[model samples]
Target: MKRWRHLALLLMLMTLALLALPAYLERAELQLWLLGPAWCG
Candidate 1:
């Protein structure tokens, strides 16, 4: 039972990370966009 609970928690965390990834990537892209010109030149 304890092992099952741990597995469930791990699965939930993985799911949450997958869901959050796109938003994280969008924020990263926005940051790059904001700084892109300065870096490029």
Candidate 2:
């Protein structure tokens, strides 16, 4: 296998992870932040 092809595959996997994790975290943070006011009060 060539170097660029391997690098491209690695980059593609990284981009996919970035897209998935942020959306997951966003939903998680929204839930946590919403509960913060009640918990703190």
Candidate 3:
């Protein structure tokens, strides 16, 4: 119900972020941005 809609909306926003992020940063930087936090631990 309402929770499903909220989850769907969050997923859509994440997909949009993925699509829009590449245009804002270089491929290498983008990879680092995605992986940086994991490597920090």
Candidate 4:
């Protein structure tokens, strides 16, 4: 039972992180786009 609870918590955190990753990447990409090619180059 204790192990199941721990696994559940880990799974929840992983799910949240996975869901958040794309949004985070999109925000980062948007910031980079705003910065422009010359700035990145």
Candidate 5:
């Protein structure tokens, strides 16, 4: 029972992180796009 609970918590966290990854990548991409040229020049 305790192990099951821990597994469920781990699964939930993994799901949340998977869901958030795209948005995090998108934000990073946008930041790079917005700032890339300035840095390059």
Candidate 6:
């Protein structure tokens, strides 16, 4: 539903931000960005 889509978008943005950071909050952020679409889908 709409909520899921919104959450997915938010996570996508987080993933992008985390990816662009020189020091990430966690290394896993990269994996989340790489796989978020499949996981979200």
lDDT of each: 0.98, 0.93, 0.90, 0.95, 0.99, 0.85
What is candidate 4's CA lDDT for residue 40? 68
Ranking by lDDT: 5, 1, 4, 2, 3, 6
- Model 2 agreement with the true structure over 1-41: per-residue lDDT tens digits: 69999999999999999989989899989988999899899
Task: Encode model 4's per-residue lDDT on 1-41: one tens digit a residue.
Answer: 99999999999999999999999999999988988886968
10 residues in a row with least lDDT, candidate 2: 31-40
For all predicted structures, in order, the TM-scores are 0.64, 0.50, 0.57, 0.57, 0.62, 0.51
As for lDDT, the candidate ahead, 3 or 4, is: 4
TM-score of 3: 0.57
Could you tell which candidate, 4 or 6, scores higher by TM-score? 4
lDDT of 5 at 16: 100
Give candidate 2's TM-score. Answer: 0.50
Residue-level lDDT tens digits of model 5 in 1-41: 99999999999999999999999999999999999999999
How many Å off is the CA of 1 in candidate 2?
Answer: 6.8
Flag regions of model 3 displaced more than 4 Å. Answer: 26-41
**What shift in Å separates residue 32 of candidate 2 from its native position after superposition?**
13
TM-score of 6: 0.51
Off by over 4 Å in 5: 30-41
At residue 13, give the lDDT of candidate 2: 97
Better of 4 and 5 by TM-score: 5
Residue lDDT tens for model 1, 2-36 = 99999999999999999999999999999999999
TM-score of 1: 0.64
